[model samples]
Target: MAQQFVDTKIKGDKVVLFMKPTCSYCIMAKDVLSKYKFKPGHLEYIDISGRSDMDSLQDYFLELTGARTVPRVFIGEECIGGGSDVVALHKSGKLEGMLKSIGAM
Candidate 1:
């Protein structure tokens, strides 16, 4: 079920963030991404905190992304890592290009 949810959410030309509302890393990632103008419905935040199946979801994330960390930022169908990673990408001027490629900006 978790797999299905994640797979469906990340399948298209969208930026999907699997995050917890209170996570500092998640906040950082969100702050960076929010600087951009995404097409409607192109940027999605799936809050994993307080969910009954959160552990299973994180397990699936570990299997799929090699990490169970929040702020799992996906640019289109790619897992672009966590908050610091996103900041790095933004600093390098590659995040915008990525968003542009997926038509999210």
Candidate 2:
């Protein structure tokens, strides 16, 4: 079920962040992503902090992404690692191109 949800969201959205509301890394990711102007409904943040199945979802993410960390960032069906990764991408000036490629910019 978690896999299905994750898969659907990743495939359907231009940008998706499987995050926890209170996580510092999640906040950092959100901060960076918020700078972009994504079409309405194209950017999604799936907060798992309040869910009863958060652990299972994280477990699924570990299998899918090889990491159990919050703020699992995905761009057009690609898991782009976490907050630090996104920040680095932004720093390297590659993030804008990636967002543009997927029509999220």
Q: Pick the lDDT winner.
A: 1
Q: List the residue pairs that clash in candidate 2.
A: none
List candidate 2 stretches off by more than 4 Å: none
Best by TM-score: 1
Model 2, span 15-86: residue lDDT tens: 999998889999999999999899888899999988888888999999989999988999998899999999
In candidate 1, how many Å is residue 78 off? 0.6
What are the runs in model 1 whose C-alpha is more than 4 Å off? none
* lDDT per residue (tens digit) for residues 1-105 in model 1: 988888999955899999999999999999999999999999999899989989999998899889998889999889999999999999999999999998887
Global Cα lDDT for candidate 2: 0.90
Candidate 2 Cα deviation (angstroms), residue 51: 0.9
Local accuracy by lDDT, each model: 0.92, 0.90
Global Cα RMSD, each model? 0.7, 1.1
